[model samples]
Target chain A: MERPAYRARVERILEHSADTRSLFLRTVTGRMPFYSPGMFISVKIPLPEELRIRPYTIATSPEDGEPFELIFNLVPNGRGAAWMFERKVGDLLDFTGPFGAFTLERAPDRETVFIAEGTAVAPIRPMLRRALSQPCSHSVHFIYAAAKPERLLYRAEFESLAVTNSRFRFEPLIVQGKELYESLSDEVARRWVHGDGERRRDFFLCGIGSGVLKLRDLLRGAGYERRAIHYERW
Target chain B: MARIRVIYENGSPERTIEFDPAAAPFQHDGQPGSVLDVLLGHGIHLEHACGGNCACTTCHVIVKQGINSLSEATEQEEDMLDRAPGLTPTSRLGCQAVIEDADADIVIVVPRYTINQVSESR
Candidate 1:
C-alpha cells in the first residue's frame, strides 16, 4: 500500500459502444508511472461512507507515451462503473498502479494467441501490438468477441494490423446470449485442437470470469502446460 | 468473536483485532470474514489486484497459527497460489481464506516480498 496515488484529469472520451468507453487521462500532478503494456491502474472512488478501489487495465502502451487510456463498460448499479461514466473533461480522479503480472515474453519462441471477450480487449490490444512490433518475430493471433458486429471494440485497428502486418491475425466473433462461452471454446478447439503439436503455442486470455476460466480449462485439457497460459478476470 | 493477529513485513508493529465471524464481509473486496476483508476493515491494506477474484496472488498471507480455522483452498486458488512468492504449506490468499470458526484465534504474516507488479495506496 505504499504506492503513491496520483491525480489525473480526463482529457478526452471515445464511445466504443452504447455502454463502453475509452477515457484518456493526463496526470495533473506527479509524473506518470512506468508501466508494462498489460499492467493496470487502480482507481479509488469515494462513496458516502468509504472509498472503493477498482482496477482498470491501461489500453495504451508505455511506448505510445501519455495520456494513457482506460476502457470500461457502464454496468448498471455498479459503483465503479457509475463513477467512471460520470467523468468529464478536466475532472480529476485518483489512481495508483501500473500493476499486473499478465505480460508477454520479451522474445516469444512460439505462436502467441491473444483472446478477448467484451471489453477485455483493453489489455489484449497492447499485448498484440508488443508481440507484433518490429524486432520481435512471432505469430500473434487475436480472437475478439462481442455481442454483435457493432460492439466489436477496436475492430478497425485489429483489422488494419492484420492487413498490414503478416505476423498478426485477427478474428472477430459475434456472440449473443448464452452461447458466448461455448462459441469461444469451440473456436479455440477448431483453430488449435487438431493443429500439429510440433509448434508450441502460448495463450493470453482476458475477459469475464466465466469465459476466461472456460478457456483456461479448455487449454489445460488440451495438454497445454499451466505455465503456457496467462489471464486476468473481473 | 475471533482474535486475529497480523505481523507486518516492513517492521511495523504487529496488530491484533477482534471481530464477530457472524457479522461477516467487513469489507467489499474479499470473501465475508476473510483475512483480506477483516484486515481492510481495520484500516489495514492488503494488495489485491483482481479485487479478490482469486485471479492474482497479491493478497497472499502465511497462517502462522490456527490454519485449521480457515477455509480450504479451492482448485483455482491453488493454481494461482503456485505463482506466489515465498509460498509455504500454510500459505493462503487473504481474500479466499474465510474464517469458519467464530471464536478461532489466528495469526498471519505478510511476507516481505511479493510478485504483484503493482504498488498500491488506500
Candidate 2:
C-alpha cells in the first residue's frame, strides 16, 4: 500500500535557540501516525520553478499526538529552511512520514549513552522521552556538544530531564573552551571506560556524517562492538 | 504507459497500476509521483518513513519481476537497503524505483515487516 501524504497545518512556532526554530504541525485529518523517537518526515516545499522535498527529524514523540514538532537551524541560504520559516500559523503544509530507524533501543542491562550535536538533538530528544517513560535500571547519559553555548539545543530540556529522571544524566559540552576543553568523543570515551567494564554499554551518535563516523570509529577502537554503536548522520 | 503489479503479502489485495513517464510523477494525491506515489494514489499505504528520500529502508519492496525495467538503484539506495530486514537480491526502495519501461510490467512484494526497531513497545 502507498503511504499517503497528509496535509498538516502550522500550529505554532517558537525560537529554540539563536538560529534554530521549532515548528509544531497538526494533521488536518487522521490521527498522527505512530513514530518512534529518531524518526523523520519529509515535507514538500513549493519553490519558484518546482516543488522540493526535504526531510526533518520529528522532535516530539508519537505519544504527544495531534501536533508534531520539528526543529531546524536556519541555513543562510537553505530553501527548505526559508520555506519553513515563512510558514504562518494555520498555513497548510504537505508532508509524509514518521520514518527512519533511529529509535531508542532498550538495553536495560547496559548503560546507554547518547551523543548529539546541533539540530541532531531533534531525534535524540524523543529517545530521551522514551527512555524516561519506562522503568529503566541501567543509567542513560546524554552528551550534547556544540561550538558555543547558545548552539547547544535542548540544554534546558535535557537538564530538566536529568533532574527528574534518576537513571538519566545530561552533559552539555561547549567546544569553545581553551586548554581545559576536551573533545566530545574523548570526554565520552573517558567516562565510558572508567565505568564498570563488566556492565556493557550502548552508544547512539547523531549529527553530521563526518562527526558520527569519527565518533563511531573512536568507540569501536575503544572495544565497543560494532552492534553496540548505532548512529544517524544528517 | 508502463504497467506495475504490486502484491501485498499481508493480504490486503494486489494491484496493477499503469503509469506514464512523460507525465512523470504521475499525479495521484497531488504529490511528486514514484512507485510509492502510484501505490499511495491507489490507496496502498506501504511504509515510507523517510518520505522517499532514500534515507531509510522502510519502503523496501522486492522487485520480483521487471527489475530491469526500473532505473538502477543508486549507491545511496543500495547502502540504505543493507540495513533492511529480510533483504533479497532483487530488493529496491520503492521511492527510488522509478518506472522507465513502458513496454514491460513490474511486480513488487512488500515484506511482512518494515519497521527496523529493536523492539515494538507500542
Question: Each prediction's TM-score against the native?
Answer: 0.92, 0.71
Across B43-83, the per-residue lDDT of candidate 2 in tens digits comes to 56666556565668777899999988878876546656777
Per model, how much of the real contact set is kept?
0.24, 0.37
Q: Count the backbone clashes (under 3 Å) in each candidate.
A: 0, 7
Best by DockQ: 1
In candidate 2, position A119 carries an lDDT of 88
**Candidate 2 lDDT (Cα, 0 to 1):** 0.75
DockQ, all candidates in order: 0.42, 0.24
Which digits, one per residue and each the tens of the lDDT, describe model 1 over residues B28-64?
Answer: 9988889999989888878876677675677889999
Docking class of 1: acceptable
lDDT of 2 at A10: 93
Model 2 chain A lDDT-worst window of ten = A177-186
